[model samples]
Target: LHTGCIPPIVHRDIKTTNILLDQNFQAKLADFGLSRSFPTGNETHVSTVVAGTPGYLDPEYYRTNWLTEKSDIYSFGIVLLEIITNQPIIQQSREKPHIVEWVSFMIRKGDIRNIMDPNLHQNYDIGSVWKATEIAMSCVSPSSIGRPNMSRVANDLKECLISENSRTGESRDMESKSMEFSMGIYTEVIPKAR
Candidate 1:
C-alpha cells in the first residue's frame, strides 16, 4: 500500500533499549507512552514541556519546546550510533560525554573507525560502516533542518546495505574469474558502459 498520507505521529521517546529484536533479529520499536498525533495543517510542531531521555532528546525541542517529527530522528540517530559502536548512549569517561559528542569528536578527528565496535573485528564491511555512521551523524546534527527525515534515513540505510551486498558479489565473481584464468580457462571481459 503506497499511501501518500503522512499523518503526524510523534514517537516522543526513542532509544536503543526501547527497541526489541525478534527471533529473526528484526528490530521492533516499543515504548510510546509520550506518543501523540496532531492533525495535518493544524500545527506540526508543538511548544510542549521538555520530555524524553536525556541523551536522545532533541536540542531544538529542548531549546524552543517545539516538538516535531525531527525530534524522533535525533533520538533514532543516537540509537543508530549505539548499534554501530555497541556503546551506551551515555558513558562516563575521564569526563562524561554523550555518545553524540563522542562520535562527533571522532568524526572531527577523521577517525570514525576508532568508534566502531572491536567485537565485529573485520567481519563488517568498512564502506557500509562509514555510510551508516554518516547517516547517524546527519540525524544528530545540531540544526533540526540539517537532519534528514526518518523515511530518508531508512531509505539511505537500505541503499547502503544493498550496495555493500552488490560489492561483495562482484568481488566473489572477480576472484572466481581470476582462479579460472590461472587454471588455463579463458575468461571473457565484459564491455564497460560508455
Candidate 2:
C-alpha cells in the first residue's frame, strides 16, 4: 500500500519480516489488521496505546502514546537498515543485538565498509549507498517531526536508485523493477487504550 488514500493509513506494525516478495521479486505489504486511517488537519496526533514490534517501535510513540504517520516511518527506517546491512533486527550476539545501534555506531566511527553487505562487494555506487543510509537515518529520528514525509522519502530513494543505475550502467528496466516491502504488526489500539 503506497498510501494514496485521503486519510493515510498508518501501519502500526512495520518490520522487515512482514514484507513478502512475489515471484518477480516485487515487494508486497502483508498483514493489514493493525492499520488505522490517520486524521488530518489541526489534530496533531491520535492518542492510543503503543503497539508494535520491539526494535522497530517508535520511541516517541512508546513514550507518549501519540500515534502519527511518522511512527510508521521509524519502522520503515529499520527495514532500510536491515536491507543495507543484511542483518536481522536483533542479532544473535548479546553485546550488540540491535542493528540500528550497530549501524549508527559503525557510521559514526567511519567504519562503514563493514556496514554494507559483503555480498555487495563494492559493486554498488558509493553515493547511492550513502544516500540510502542517510534516508534510513532520517526516518529513525527520535523526534517524529524530524522525519521526512513519505513524498520526500520517495523522491530521495528514487534519486538514490537512479544514481545507482547510472553509476553501474545497469539497464533502465531494472531500475523500474526495484521495490520495498513493509512489515506490519496487527493490532487495534483504541483511543481509550491510551
Model number with the top lDDT: 2
- In order, candidate lDDTs are 0.75, 0.79
Over 3-30, each residue of candidate 2 has an lDDT whose tens digit, in order, gives 5776868888888778998997777788
**Regions of candidate 2 where Cα sits further than 4 Å from its true position:** 1-3, 92-95, 173-194
Clashes of each: 0, 2
Candidate 2, residue 146: lDDT: 98
Candidate with top TM-score is: 2
**RMSD (Å) of each candidate, 1 decimal:** 10.9, 9.2
Candidate 1: tens digits of C-alpha lDDT, residues 1-194: 00133666778889877888888566677987887665678565877888899889999999999988889899999989998888888888714378888888887787767788878775667777787898899999998889987667765665566667686664343233212222232334322211
